[model samples]
Target: MASPDGNHRHPETNGEAKPPAPKKQKLSTSITDSEIQSEFSHHDASVARINNGSFGSCPQSIISAQQRWQLRFLRQPDSFYFNDLKAGILESREFIRSLINADDVSEVSIVDNATTAAAVVLQQIAWGFTEGRFQKGDVAVMLHYAYGAVKKSMEAYVTRAGGRVVEVQLPFPVSSKEEIITEFRRALERGKENGQRIRLAVIDHVTSMPSVVIPVKELVKICREEDVDQVFVDAAHGIGCVDVDVKEIGADFYTSNLHKWFFSPPSVAFLYCRRSAKLSDLHHPVVSHEYGNGLAIESAWIGTRDYSAQLVVPSVLEFVNRFEGGIEGIKKRNHEQVVRMGEMLAKSWGTQLGCPPDMCSSMVMIGLPWCLGITSERDTLKLRVHLRDRFAVEVPIYYRAPKEGEVDPVTGYARISHQVYNKVEDYERFRDAINKLVGDKFTCASLSA
Candidate 1:
């Protein structure tokens, strides 16, 4: 098995690092099919559960580990909170740091979720503007496909600080990577043209609604070239869903949710500040006793709350590593499954893929056929509820509005997420259910002009 440091090299036989041999499959009495099913027994068995992108399903092992931590806290509240919690928190941080290849573990702060992590950075930047560190006409750059909450956070803080939010409009059916980089450059130039300082640029590691994976490293390089002071990566779907190396990406700040892909419980995430990023005034939203005690410590103790989820980070990593050929194996399987399923559904429904396969992680966004009666956001939400309630299939249906002053109709996408517990049968059921629901009302020609 590969170590958490991501090193896969074996001993050299002839001046070349050899790869590890594949593990042989063996029948195990303990880990049975029923046991594997029991791992995800917490979910509704009847539901297709194709929405792991929204909230990942936690395994029995991780849940048990968190329960154990919660039990310890209940038994010895004082000792666990004061004596042992800090050490456990540090261990979790170290494990995550090694996983993401962060340079300094001290720079990684465990927050409630990715939104809170982003809030920390945006709030700090707002403070900088108030304290004269940033100029009056400073602007924050963001993409149109950014997570709605993070975009609102950036807009709120920037507007409050007398700064402008420069939104870079990206096409729904995205083109090449160079096109994205060019759009960002154009947005920055337009900001400068309007006398904006362009203080920060918030880019997504994996977009939420559109479900497209942006080339963050190249985007960061473009931000640097455009003289954007800080590059904050809203990597809400980053850590476990895709390959993420903070050191390699070289972003000023990166935040990801462990609950989404790390298989951890809800409200567990991390914020990584690069060592070279000069963010001195960053603090958590909740002002706890450790407010002035540095970033990690300040984020560690955010009032009296449930620390079981955060404390189980190491256990979650280990559990995922032990399950089905570990994290890399799981990711590979999910990517293959999602890509295959996406292609199959697109072909079956006579629709198109939202983005290229290479740009997809484990989530694939399939363009909805126009005949599905989804013309607005309200219709999309109604369809989502209908699928969940009537068909027992839980999936996300989002609508992307056309660009300003364009005659293009609104685009709809149904993003399907593939996890370890999911099989092809689940998506097949989804396809059949959609077909039955729409019948001959939807067809390939419905999308043709």
Candidate 2:
């Protein structure tokens, strides 16, 4: 059970997982029920608009239509005239395909969220690893910025399979694109030198902790040139956060939760495999009738559970086009807000922002004041309380631990996500709350006026 260096593993390797060591940080506001209700009010109102204004394809509606068609199914059961039912599904796929700029409908499959997508991809690797396709010396790489669940999974997998997980510790107070590129390259090069054939890698297009975007395209190119076989991207915070084009990133696979940024209903997410990769060779996370479909569309539609979430994708895409400036229009708006929040956080904390101002699209990680010395889990607990109890806000707090060259990648930091649903006042409350709690140990004051 020796984990290999540069190898990626899932967080739950043996179930005795370490709570994401979310170093101690400061929080000022509370996330009370009122706050949740407020946010939900806005979200729910948006949903109400959907039922009345327009309906692309909703579960309740789609099922009603299916029932009308399946009235025949009740009697025949064998050959129910399912022409309209199948047409609806096909139309939904086409709508999603256009929104993502995917190569074809064949490459897309809906899931619940980014985490599930990552799990499915991990299952593919695990299936291979257990079959002796990967051994002790092989390596995989992930970053401190990779979501906690994704990173933990990579670690668990690598360590359990006798492979090494090269956890790339990205530097904080990052100044420029070059700094980011340098950090990622260093990780890849270090893994290469450590006698680890970097087989797979995962990165977030837009990170949750520090809300920075990595140089994914460059990373993908480097991996392929270095002979890395696969790249899995977690876009939980990116789908509606940015205008994603799979053809542009060049990764073997990419996954995202449409519900987050796209404002889709609660559970619409998707996984995309490049046309080059054959799905028949890829294994589903849960072995189903369509496990080894080998590039077949059936795999994406497998299982018998409710597909309402998957079907809502088309309506969600339609909604985004209607209100928030549709794709490019909305993406530009998010970037603007993110920059405003980043600048404010930077000035107050007196620390350079996490990534270059323009480096990210919809998220930004700003340095904040916090306790002198704090641990990851303890820090996370505090922020969780502060945001929920005082601020009535919901956000992710993260800590990166040390590895080499850079200060312990583990630092007490917090990031604010500016989704379509967020407003300028929300960030103001966030900044004010920090000022009240951290006060001085927060540093970055010299940078502040």
Evaluate all candidate structures by whole-model CA lDDT and list the values in order: 0.80, 0.59
lDDT of 2 by residue, 1-449 (tens): 11111112223212222222212222344334454344345343322111110111122322333344335335553342222223334444555666667877667766666777787777667656777877666777888678888877776665566667777777666666677677778888877885667878887887666667777888888788878878988877666667688888888888877666665555667788887634446545555654455322443445544444554444445444443346566678767877787788768756546677677776666655444233455666566455556656555555545446754233555666554445567777667766766654432222212
RMSD of every prediction: 7.4, 13.4
TM-score of 1: 0.89
Poorest 10 consecutive residues by lDDT, candidate 1: 13-22
What's the lDDT of the predicted structure labeled candidate 2? Answer: 0.59
The window of 10 residues in a row where model 2 has the poorest summed lDDT is 48-57
Model 1 stretches astray by more than 4 angstroms: 1-34, 402-410, 440-449
Compute each candidate's TM-score over C-alphas.
Answer: 0.89, 0.73
How well is each residue in 1-449 modelled by candidate 1, as lDDT tens digits? Answer: 22122323232322112233223333233244576687988888898989999987789887887888787788888977655677667767777787788876777889999989888989988987899977887888899888989878877887789787888888778757777888888888878986768888999999988898899999898888777889999999987788999988989899999999888999799999987547766888889888787788888787888888887876676566565667787898889899999999988877778888998999999976665766677777778777787678999988876566744343678999998888788899889877776685753223422
